[model samples]
Target: MTPPGPCPRPLSRALIVAEARRIADEEGLGSLTVRRVARRLGTGQASLYRHITDRGQLLSLLAGDVALRLPLCADRGDPRERLRDHWLAAHDHLARHLWAARVIADGEHAVGTAAAFADGALGALAEAGLDPDDAARAHRVLWNLLLGHLLNAHPVGRTGTPRRHGDGSRSDFSWALSRVLDGVLAGQPAGGRWRLGR
Candidate 1:
């Protein structure tokens, strides 16, 4: 009888993602690469590729990890305020990870939690009286603004403490948000009880 070949290790993408997250959290997202992850895991880079297509895919996975914890869907309140709260919360969450915001900013990495968060945002805009197309466009615009703020606010290679919702930051964000809302919500009152995407 022919001898069996060497057994392959189990596919543990969760473990790979966890290690990648650690590297990103400690050093920064730029530091996270398949080579680094493989070296850290004591495996060949080819092995990692078997699970993750590329660094971009790994980034999406990392964003998915953070999105799972992101708090979306604000409680009942003035629709404008609710929308404001959701964005602030999102910013705070994305600020922690060096690259998650950058990755998710593409808006195509709609993994499980990310998609839910976006749905909540779209719903809020719809509730505020925007039609489906307008709500989608508005959401994308806000995402662009938010991702730009995050990428610029923190310098590259930054690590350590995540950003906090301090008074100045909060006030600034609130002001900016209000400006966009004023334009998008012009002549439209909040709390319209509308659904997203019709």
Candidate 2:
């Protein structure tokens, strides 16, 4: 069999990003490495450096790339449904790349796609009668719940394992997601009881 040829210089950056994303998706982000990506592309590490600076940059790009994959859409339903859809999309996206949740939580970098996502979410909340301040708070609440649930629902090395809920399981991620959305819509925090005062 002919040995794989080196990745051409022109396509190096795109190919590197694509390969990095594939590695993260199939083998979990923890497994993604510069060496692994280089090997997969049949290129030397130096070649990769021409396009990507380091592992941290590569991860940032990966996060941005993942964020860009989220489908942008205009508002269509009540704030509750819009928020639910946003949560589900974010959940599924992070679920696909378990490592991304950590990168995002760390606030390492911001990309246009992530910004757009934040805009959509805030727009929905604001349109639903939240002031800018309240919308921002709601956005934080939703994101926190998403990250926390994703971290627990998907453990390292357990990707693709179906969550068990039948037979009296205590952990129900879906149920919890719904309740969180409801709470957001009801003008309450995810884990807080309704109070008379602000």
Candidate 3:
């Protein structure tokens, strides 16, 4: 019966990844499975397996793909501003891919992009006179704080509260982020001598 005639055109890995990410963005990670992805791609499950071995590998690739978009800079500028911008960008990214954050937080996924971000942040902190170890620790602490705050401030499936702010609206996320950043900056040894006073 012509043996499928070489299958017309090969499935694009990029397309598959994009589609998978979209599904996760829309439906959450729990709904992302091999069968579901194949259905969304309009292809056979086996075809997807040819590109991705399992869900773990797929999630890793997805997280790394998202992480690559993080704005990691090395200008040696103000650590507080740099950190604020970094965390803000991360918050925006995580907000977009809520499922990814859920999966990563659950320890079901590993993020290559997150590691790159951490390395960049740590280097920047070190360049700002923070000790190497302290820089790393500080980055971790900031990330966790931001993640926790964001997750708590905006829980899933709550539609009553507003998501964004307007001219007269309160900036809950911004306020929380600023407070966290203030704490981090205050605790640093360089410009944070006041922290020891308290």
| lDDT top scorer | 1
Taking all chains together, each candidate's TM-score versus the true structure is: 0.70, 0.76, 0.74
Tell me the tens digit of each residue's lDDT in model 2 across 1-198: 564577655546778889998988788777899998997788878888998899988988888888887644357766666676777776776677777777778887676677778888888777666678987987888778777776564345344656541211223445666786666567544333334464
How well is each residue in 16-96 modelled by candidate 1, as lDDT tens digits? 898899899789877888988887777778988888899888888887889887778775677777888888887787766
Give the Cα lDDT of each candidate: 0.76, 0.72, 0.67
The predicted structure with the larger lDDT, 2 or 3, is 2
What would you estimate as the lDDT of candidate 1? 0.76
Instruction: Give the clashing residue pairs of candidate 1, or none.
Output: none
Question: What does the lDDT come to for candidate 3?
Answer: 0.67
For model 1 the local lDDT of residue 52 reads: 88
lDDT of 2: 0.72
Segments of candidate 1 deviating more than 4 angstroms: 1-11, 42-50, 105-113, 153-171, 190-198
lDDT minimum window of 10 residues, candidate 3 = 163-172
Clashes of each: 0, 0, 0
